[model samples]
Target: MNWDTIQGNWKQFKGQAQQKWGDLTDDDLDKAEGNREELEGRIQEKYGRSKEEAKKEVDDFMSSL
Candidate 1:
């Protein structure tokens, strides 16, 4: 699904996201609140990834689901 669909169904996807990015804290997910940009920022902070890298990772994650 696309980011908008994923955002709308964040509750369903939250656990999967946590599983994918184990370093991200619960509070980080809470703050993200289904915002792709926010989640990407959190991933970048926690994983020391470049913005493009994070976006690519997120895209891959979405595709896997």
Candidate 2:
């Protein structure tokens, strides 16, 4: 989904996001608040992944939903 769709559906999406990326805390999701860049950065930091890897992981997780 696009950023707008993700933002619009964040409440529902967050559960799935948590399941997919367990390292992400609720605060991280709240802080992200549908901002793709922030979410990517948090994922990268939490998972110790490169930017591309984090983006790919996020993309894969979202696509799976």
Candidate 3:
């Protein structure tokens, strides 16, 4: 799905994201609230990933969807 669709349906997709990144807590997803950059930040913090890596991972996740 496209970013627009995912953003619009974040309530649904956040669960999928949590599954993919198990270290992320519900609070992190809640804070992201459909914002891709925020989600990337949460992943970067939780996963000890570089900003580029987090962005790439989010991009890959979007592509998979």
Q: At residue 49, what lDDT does model 1 achieve? A: 98
Across 1-65, the per-residue lDDT of candidate 2 in tens digits comes to 67689889999899988888898999999999888889999989998999999889878876887
- Residue 58 of model 3, lDDT score: 94
Q: In candidate 2, which residue pairs clash?
A: none
- Candidate 2 residue-wise lDDT at 31: 95
Q: What's model 3's TM-score?
A: 0.95
Error of 2 at 16 (Å): 0.5
**Candidate 3 clashing pairs, residues 3+ apart or interchain:** 1-65
For model 3, what is the alpha-carbon lDDT of residue 50?
Answer: 100
Best by TM-score: 1
Misplaced by over 4 Å in model 3 are none
CA lDDT, every model vs. true structure? 0.95, 0.88, 0.93
Pick out the ten consecutive residues of candidate 2 with the lowest summed lDDT: 56-65
Each model's TM-score?
0.96, 0.91, 0.95
Best lDDT goes to which candidate?
1
Query: Over 4 Å off in model 2, which ranges?
Result: none
